[model samples]
Structure formats: structure tokens, C-alpha cells
Target chain A: MDLTADMTNQPFPTQLFGDDAIDTAEEKAKPSSRQTVGDPFVENPRMICRDVYVYYAEKCAINNVSIDVGRNEVLAMIGPSGCGKSTFLRCLNRMNDTVGTCRVEGDIRLDDMNIYDPSVDVVPLRASVGMVFQKPNPFPKSIFDNVAYGPKIHGLVSNKTELAEIVETSLTKAGLWNEVKDRLHEPGTGLSGGQQQRLCIARAIAVSPEVILMDEPCSALDPIATAKVEELIAELREQFSIVIVTHAMQQAARVSQRTAYFHLGDLIEVGPTDRIFTNPRHQLTEDYITGRFG
Target chain B: MQNTPQQSPITLRINAGLKKRYNTEKRFKRMGISAIVIAMTFLVFLFGSIISNGYTAFQQTYIQLDVSFDQTFFTGENLAAANFPGLVKKTLYSMFPDVTSRNDKKLLTQLVSSNAAFRLMGMVTKDPKLIGTTQKIWVLADDDVDMLIKGHYDRNVAESNRRINDKQLAWIDALAANGKITKKFNTQFFTSGDSREPEQAGIWGATRGSIYTLFIALALSFPIGVAAAIYLEEFAPNNGWTDLIEININNLAAVPSIIFGLLGLAIFINFWGMPRSTPLVGGLVLTLVTLPTIIIAGRAALKSVPPSIREAALGIGASKIQMVTHHVLPLAMPGMLTGTIIGMARALGETAPLLMIGMIAFIVDIPGSVTDPATVLPVQIFLWADSPERAFTEKTSAAIIMLLAFLMLMNGLAVYFRNKFERKW
Candidate 1:
């Protein structure tokens, strides 16, 4: 109940949008309306979402939020529960398309191509932009197969030996190869939670995506495993531009170059990680950091 | 405070209410265990009764003899009229050399099976050299002799009230003295076709019918059911139409199987003019009954797969189709098959639906193809059950055993697949 309380203040989506003015009602919840806000853009961005609006059936879940993911940088999106941080992350890879009623509006681009364009095939777009989830979901297969699934599907390797090499390299990048090399044929689900999370990361990386999205990847792990995954994420950012959604502000400060704060589905502040943590910003962002309220 | 809390001002103590709660919890646990035990007892009782009645059927009584097989036996052009019974009667008469009345001869021939002639003919056909041989052979004994040997016949009772009279019992005793009467495996019950004579009836025809019908049901239901489930669960928009479809599928699963029989009668036979009582037609009816079960079970199976797996697949740039086919379908296959097995088992045991589809008839020949007229094992059991002959009861029980075996075999396959493809997420 505690974990779910913040995501949805009201019990139902239908209750949130009782009438046709849901868009206007969602607009009023944004703190930007009351004060001027600083810019969150950069000169060279890898992926950009402009005036994005997401709705679940008739209810607006994320209203008029825009942010840019920088090239080869760790951009951490931190927010309380149900603030649409995870939802916004899924949109980058078009993972929301799996939901029957979830609809996304506005322009979202990866590099020069508009990913939301009708002509775009989500398969290649997803291949170019990878994602790792909070809970580890290893296919019901051997560890080696789990990691090789992406590369095999994309035909990244010309032969089995090359595929094995790609799997080894991906696992090494995810920092899981050493512990799991001898047991690559064992089920991936048999690994420790941290190791399985690393396996998912390895699976994601095997396809050689330019960007990777992680949704609270350590929330289901113990502290020790979380620390290992944190280390892995720090190392992974060097090769792939990473976007992480986390509730742990310290994790945001520790692993990110820049941090963005989301509240009530609004992007309240974005700045250098040190400045966002130390310097004062908007009242909502200040209160959130000081443990006053989510 | 922690150490002295028991003696604090609140004066906490173990009360009657707390003790009662603990007692109730224990009682609940005990009752739950008792419920499971009761259910297990019923299952054990059911299987016990069926096996006790059916096991005797697998091994039939036989009488060993040294009947001379000469060229005169097959004098007729057609072997169906071969005088193997006359020869056996003569051999029995020579063995006793004491009974000579027409009544005694008639009762003495009852010691061996009526199909004893066919048994000899089968041997001669298998080896032509036997036509001139005086080889010892074990021939099938009559069902009454079979019961007498199996200890089911009480010779102490009045001979007039019982199936075998005292004269036939005397012949059986004479044969028993020479170690001629024995219990051999009843291979004919499995190899031969249906017969008016209970002893000659075998389950092969009905077994073939069940196999064809079940395969047809599975082939028709599995793909369509799984596809419909995937569409409803993963693709269909949430609206009145899909909701109605979901409700219809759920209701269909609960609809009486007999209703499907009527539907099959009207659609497949009456309207389409398909042959009645054939496995192909029976299979179609069973498909109609099994589709809803598979669809419901397939949806549950697909639903049991966590959303995280779907997210992981989709997150890695796999298309929606890839996400479902590569991940969701494989994960759900075990459950789908388990459901399909249950549905097929239900179909295998179904008789009411087959009755309307003409599978309740007395089919004599073993069905060679799906279109040939045939009855499933349960229907064969039903027809045998309806016969007035006392000997048909054992054959009915044996057929019931055969039906049960088919059910267990299908379920065993389901369990194997469940364990084989079982995920550890």
C-alpha cells in the first residue's frame, strides 16, 4: 500500500477524469504555471521529447512534459511514485505501445529520426533504443541463451562462435560474466536477483543499442546487489547513453551527470547533479529534496 | 520498558480470546487437512473399484489341447465356415471317452470359446505347415469358463440358476485335473473387432475411434483457441464487443456438453450432410465443446506470464509480434497444453455428444480412417453396458478401464510438457 499510495492519489483512472476537461485539470497540477522555470535543453542531445502528453484511456497521466537525453551521459529522472517517470521512460522506446489503452501524443525523436512517425517500425526503433526493467525477467532459457536472444534475433553475428563472443562481451560489460561464465547453461532465473538484473542488462546491451532505459532497476534487490548494479550502471554509461528512473535521490546524485525532478507528472527542475542536490531551486523541488513531501 | 512490559500499567496477560483465536487457527488447519484426505479417499476408492473390476479382463481363461490339424479342416473355399469347433468337440469327446449324449456333447463344447475355430484358423493361416500337424495349442476358453477359472463362478450354488450347469463344470474339472485350463493374456480383447459374442469383442475399434476424434479435436481447437486468446488478451480493444466475446467464451465453457451434441447434429450432419457416427464428425463436435475450454485456459496461461517479461522483450526493441510469439507464447504453451489435455480428456470421456452424432451405434469393424463409422471408447462402454448378456459386463468394465487409461495418458503428457517447458521466473 505504501509503495502504491503515491502513484495514484485517487483509486481509479476513471475517477481522475470524471468529465471531458481532463487535459485542463492535468495542466493545473503543473508547478511551472505558478513560476518561471529554467531550461533543460542542451546543444547536442541524443533523444528529445517535446510537449509530450500521455493518457491512459480518458485520463491524462503525463501532461505537457518535455526533456532531452544527452549523448553518452547518464540522465537520471527522479520522482515520487505515480509521477509518470517510468511511463515517460517507456515512451522513449515506445514500450507503451504494448498497453491496449495507453496513448502517447507529441513529438519524440531519437537523433534525427522522429520515432513517433507513422512510417517508423517499432522493431528497429526498439533495437536502436534498449530497455531494462525494475524486476529481472530472464527468459525461461539458459543464461547464455538469455543474453544471446537479442543478437540472434537481429542477426548481429554471422556464426555461433561470434554470437557466443557477443554474449561474453555483453555479460562482461554488465559485469556478470565472471560470476556466471561457468554456469552459462544454467537458467538465468536461478541467479541471484542482482545477477539476474545484470543479465537483463547484458541482454539489453547484446543488441548494441545506442541508448538504454532502466526503470528502477535496483528496487527489487538487496542493498548489496543494488550497489553492484549501481557500479555496473556507472560503467555502462561510458558506452551507451543511459536514462534511469529512480526513487533513491542518493542514487540519482551518485550515478547521474544531470538530474531531473518530476512531480505530479511535471518536470519541475533539471540541472547539474551537484547543483540540484546542493543549491536551492523551485519550492517543490526544494521541499522534495529536504524530505518535506513527495 | 521492553524487559518489564509484562508488569507495566497496561497489565498485559494471555487472555481467553487470544487462546481461542489460536485454537481456531489450529482447528482450521486440521479441517483443511481433513478435507484433502477425504478427497484423496474418494479418488482411491474410485480407482480401486475400477481396477478390481477391470484387471480380470486383461487375462482370460484358456484350455490347452492337442487337436490334430489336417487338410480336411479347410475343405471349404471360405475359411469363415471352417469346422474348427467340430474338431474341438470331437477332441473333447475323445479326451473324456465317457459322455456320448447330444446334451453332453453340446455342454462339453461350451468348455472352449466359440471362436476357438477362428483361433485355429488364425494359427493355420499364420503357418501353412500346421494344416498337416498334430501340434498342442492353447485356445481361448468360454467367458463362463473364464469366470469359472477366475473363481467368480460359485459351483456350490444350484446349477440351474447359474450360467454353467453341473455337466459343463464337470468338463472344466476334468480339464483342470490335466492342467489344461489356465489363464493366458487376453490379446484378442485388444486385437479383434467387436462381436455379438462378448468373448470375441475387443476395444481396438473404439480405441481407434477415440484416437481419431481426439486428434481432430486437438488439431481444430489448439491453434484457433490460442489465437483467439492472444487476440482477446493482448490485442482487442476494451469495449462492448470484446467484453461480450469474452463473456460468450466463458459461458460456452460452462454450457452443457449435450448442447454441443445437438449443435453438431444440426450443423455437421443434418445441414452439411456429413456421414454420421464417424470419428471425423465426432471430432468436429468435440472441437466445438473443447474450444471454449482451451480459449479460457490459454488466456489464463498467457495472463500468468508476468508483464515484466513482455516489457523486457518490448524494451529490447522486439516488435509486438516478436514479444508475444518469442516470449509470451512459449511461456504459456505448457498451461495451454494442460488445459487442452483436460479438454481432450473430457472429450474422450464424452458420450452424450457422440450419441447425437451417431457414435452410439454398434460398430463391428475397426475404424480404418476418420470417416469410417465408429464409436469412441466411452460409447463402446455405453453400448456394452446396455447389452442383456451377463458376459458383456466384464467387457464393459474393461472398456471403461481403456477409457480411463486414455485419460491418464493424455494427462501424463500434459504433466510432462508442464515440467519440460516450466519457467523459473
Candidate 2:
């Protein structure tokens, strides 16, 4: 394909690490021969992804990569731009179905059910695995309705009071109930940027999904908001499994238990966050963590 | 980032060019202002001419006369069939007993409108007690006499060119001397229907027809156009077939309105056998003409809705239809309503398509329903403009004023809906 030809024409970032690192990294890191180090599996996983590949038309956006999201655990995928971390994260909930030319191939299962099966409906699958986007995208509705929209559409509540209770619980879980309690009737878009992102998180959890996919959920917030969201992520890990794609390695180390590092659509390494950050195994992962190359 | 006072060569050159750039900007601003000024001038001139020419049509000339309803005519059961014109003529001749030539008598009778007799019949029928009394009443003056009284015709011009001859003018002057000839508010223009006589014509029938036609067109086109827009914009797959459909809709919007009229003529009038000149067929034809426009506009409105909202709804597990209805539709509704209203405005002012559907027929009765034969406002204006009578020129301009007012009203409603429903995201 034209994409592989283009990728070969561009200089690899690892090549800038000087003679010794380049000699060793190139010998082991041919595009077809690259392999993931450390364990990519978990016991009783919430979601099991095996040999997943994604394509956008003729471009292979996601090369063969495998990872697992354990139940009640936070899994963070950190990579540079154009590394396909977000693409892999989106594959977890089949949000890539919205893209007309996008194609995903592999076995992806939520619990025992294969999510990629043709017979599986995405509506219920999405309800079971909700997502939060990079930018704060709250519905242009009241703050209360933003959280209630999911449960209402999924028919999780039978009465107004029950729906209101769900909204309050979701907001409380997202750590946004206090600041937005007085203005629950106001438009969600009227909130601060960080508050809006939290409202989106609330909206996602309102459906009671077992796993939540967050694509750079705090990337658009300020430092304080980012800290708050990182705190919320840690707190949320006790209930729902999470798969977050972030550019910030510090955020991944701070919030995630297991960290996966992607380089050019290839999963380079997977291990405990402390081991990956302090003592990485793969040469590319070491170069990335040492700030030699992104 | 600090500015240095010691100028470099580049700074010196830039300072030299600054005056030129400022002068160019000043010229551009002046040109823009002048463009606006020119447009405003033309608009003011247009309104000024229409108002000046059409204002006189609202007040009609009347000639007061004493008519003795005669016991012979009153004895008959059909009071509408009485010779009320002869009674008015006898009263005219009694005022001037010496002028007794057949030609002069005919000219004297021409001073009052031919509709004056019917006006007298209507008054007597409504009040039966006035039949035997010689009551003084103001009757409508003829169109020519009305023009003369309203100064529409030059009195110093040659008598051959004048609509009212010297003989008729002399009789009008005599009546004026006796305080019998005066102008009154033209209630006939609003109360009655169309007539061959320019002085008797009214726009109420055509206005009602326009209302009915626009109503049917809006009711049919708005829903279908919006639905088609939603399907094409949201649900349809991105393929060559959808692209072709989008292209066809845009092309249809540019098709000449007359082609739609011809299609209406063949399908609605010939095949369907609907009434030829009724508001229903005209409205259907107008719907065909406006549907493409409404669809294009509605699609644009839907496109203007931010895609982030759609993604947000979908992320929450709402189905495609639910996402569109709950978030995207509300966001796009104001734009869609505005587009529909503007399309209706264009439909209201359209005359070519209606002409092909036989809506240009000389309909004189107010339409009672959508199926009744009628002519819309523009068609009425077209008909009046084609008439050779001098008074119809003013009537045509008056109808144009009414049409402009109606168009303004629809546009105002569009703006109101747009502002009322516009939500910030």
C-alpha cells in the first residue's frame, strides 16, 4: 500500500538515538518482525483484544496489536501523535463504525460475547462500553439531562425520580455533583471546560457500562482540572474498567496500573506502570521514556 | 519584543509604505459605504414611487345625488332589478334642464360610474323604507371622472387624448360647485371582488387566493423537504447514488419555474383531472417549484448543526434516529423553519407557474376553499397591469404594495423564528 511505502520513506525516530541504539533497534524492529514484550493478558479480563488490525481505506492505521482491559482496573495507552493509540482505544467500543472507510479485523470480546460479530448490535454494545472524547463534548442540554440522557435512552429508569437519582449518582461518581448541583437545570455547555468534561464522564457512567473508553479526556482542561480528572480516574477504577489513551506519560503513571506503549501503530511494551516508566524493556519504549525521541 | 527607535532599512521602507496602505484602506471603506448608499437610494426611490402612485387608489371619487326611488319600482318584489340608473340620470338632467341633447344626455350619464346603480340597489335592499324616499346619497364616479378629479389626467391636454371630454368635465365642475362631487375612502377596494370596471375592482379575492395557495404549498413542501433533507444528510450512505441525488436536487432548484408549471399542466390538470384554476393545483405546482429550494436549505441547516453533538448522543448509546431527533433536529429546527418560510415567500410572489396552471384567469369571487378557482396577488397585478383603463395603473401599483407588504410579513416571521429558536452551543 502507499502508506507502507510512505512509512519506509520517512526516517524512524529511533534512528536518531545514535549508532549503538540504532544498530540494535533496527535489527529487532523491522515493521513485520516487531513484537510486544511483557504480558498482554489479564486474569478474568473485562475486554479481550487479540491480533486487532485497523485500516482506513488503503492505509493500515493499526498494525497487529493485542491488549487486555482487566475488570476494575485502569489501562493507559501512551504514545506520540499518529501512533494509533486513540484508534486502538476506539476499537474497544466499536466507535470506529461511524467512519465510513474504516475497517477493523480481529477478535474483540466483551466478557464472553464477541463484540465484532455481525449479529451483535452496536447500540447495546455501546451502552455496555461507553466512551468519553478528547474534547469536552457535553450535549447542548441541561446539566441534569446530560447525565440522564444515557439512562433514558437505554430505558434504565422507569420514573422521573429514578432518573434523577441516577443523574445524581453519576454526577457524584464523576466528582461534579457539588459544583453543578445548583445549576443542574442550566445548559451543560454553560459550564466551565473542566466541569463540562466531568459532565461527559458522568454521562458515560450513567449507563452503568462495565468498561469506559476515554480518549484524552483531560487533554483540553487546565492543570488543576487535569489533576482533578486524574484523581477521578483513580477513584473510578474501583468500579468500572477503563482504557485511556493519553499523550502525557506522567498522567498514565499517575492513574494507570498497567501501561501500554505504542509506536507507529505497533504495541512496543506492556507492563506495570512503575516498571514501564522506570525500567522499560523495549528499546523504543526506553528511548521514549528517556525523552530521546517521542 | 521591544521596539527600537533607531530604524533599520526594513523599518524605514515599511514606514514609507504605511501611508499608502492607510490611503488604500480609506478608499476601500469609502467604496463600501458608497455601495450601501447606492442600494439604499434605489430602495427608497422604489418605495417612494409605489407609495405616491398607489396611495390615491385607497380613496375613490363620489358624486352626491338625490334619488326618488319611485313607487312603481318599489311595488316590485325584486328590488335589485329596478331601474336605479335611470333614477340617478333623471336627477342629473333635472339639475340642468336646458341641456337636452341625446349626445349630451349620454355624456352626462357617463359622469357617474356604471356601478352606481348597483350601489343604490344594495342600499335600498338593505333598507326597504328608503325605496319611496328621495334620499341624498354619495354614489361612485366613473373611472374617467375619478381620474379627472384625482388630477391623474392633464386638463390642458387635447380633448381627444383625455379620457373625460369637455362635456363630462363641465358637468363634474357643476357638481363640484354644488358640493356634490367629493372623494371618500374606497371601502369597495377592500370589501368587494374584482370587476371589469377599474373603479370597482378590489384585491380581497386575490389576497384570499394567495393565502390559500401559500398555505397548501407550505403544508405540503415543508415536511417532505425536511424529511428528505434528514434522510440524505444523516441516514444515507456516502456513495455515488447519494451524490447523484444531491446534484439532482440542486439542479432542480435552478430549473425554470415555468417547467414546473408545464408539469403541473400535464400531470395535475390533464392526468389527475384536478380543477384547472383552483388554489389546490396552483399550490401543488408551487410546491414542486419550492421543494428543491426547501430541501437544499434544510440540508444546509442540518449541516450547520455541530457534529460533536451527534457524536455525544451516539457515545451515550442512543440510536441514530434518536440522536438526530433529540439533539441535531432541535439545533437545526430554527434554520429549517427559516428556510421553509423564505421558500413560502418565494412561492407567494411567483406568477409564471400560476399563469401556466390557468391561475391568471379573471376570477372575481373570493375563494371559499383550496379547490375553488382563484387568482393570486401577482396574477391580479398582472391582469390589472394589462388592462387599457387608466385607473388600472394605480390599481396595479396598489396591488404591488400589498404584495410587498405580504412578502415583508413572511420574511419578518422567518427572522422571528430564526432568532427565537437559535441556540448557542
Best by DockQ: 2
Each model: TM-score of chain B? 0.92, 0.95
TM-score, predicted candidate 1 vs. hidden true structure: 0.87
lDDT of 2 by residue, B170-284 (tens): 8889899999999999999987768999999999999999999999999999999999999999999999999999999999999999999999999999999999999999999
TM-score of each: 0.87, 0.93
For residues A1-294, write the lDDT of model 1, one tens digit per residue: 242432232222322222223223233224445231344665467877777889999988888876678778899998788988999999998888878789999888887688989999988888989998988888878999999999888878999999999999999999998999999999888998999999999999999999999999999999999999999889988888999999999999989988888877777777678877886356667778889886
lDDT of 2 at A272: 80
**lDDT (0 to 1) per candidate:** 0.84, 0.88
Residue B182's lDDT in candidate 2: 97
Kindly list the per-residue Cα lDDT of model 1 for residues B46-115, writing each as its tens digit: 8888788788888888898788876787788776577777878877788888898988888888778888
DockQ of each: 0.57, 0.63
In candidate 1, position A54 carries an lDDT of 95
What is the C-alpha local distance difference test score of candidate 2?
Answer: 0.88
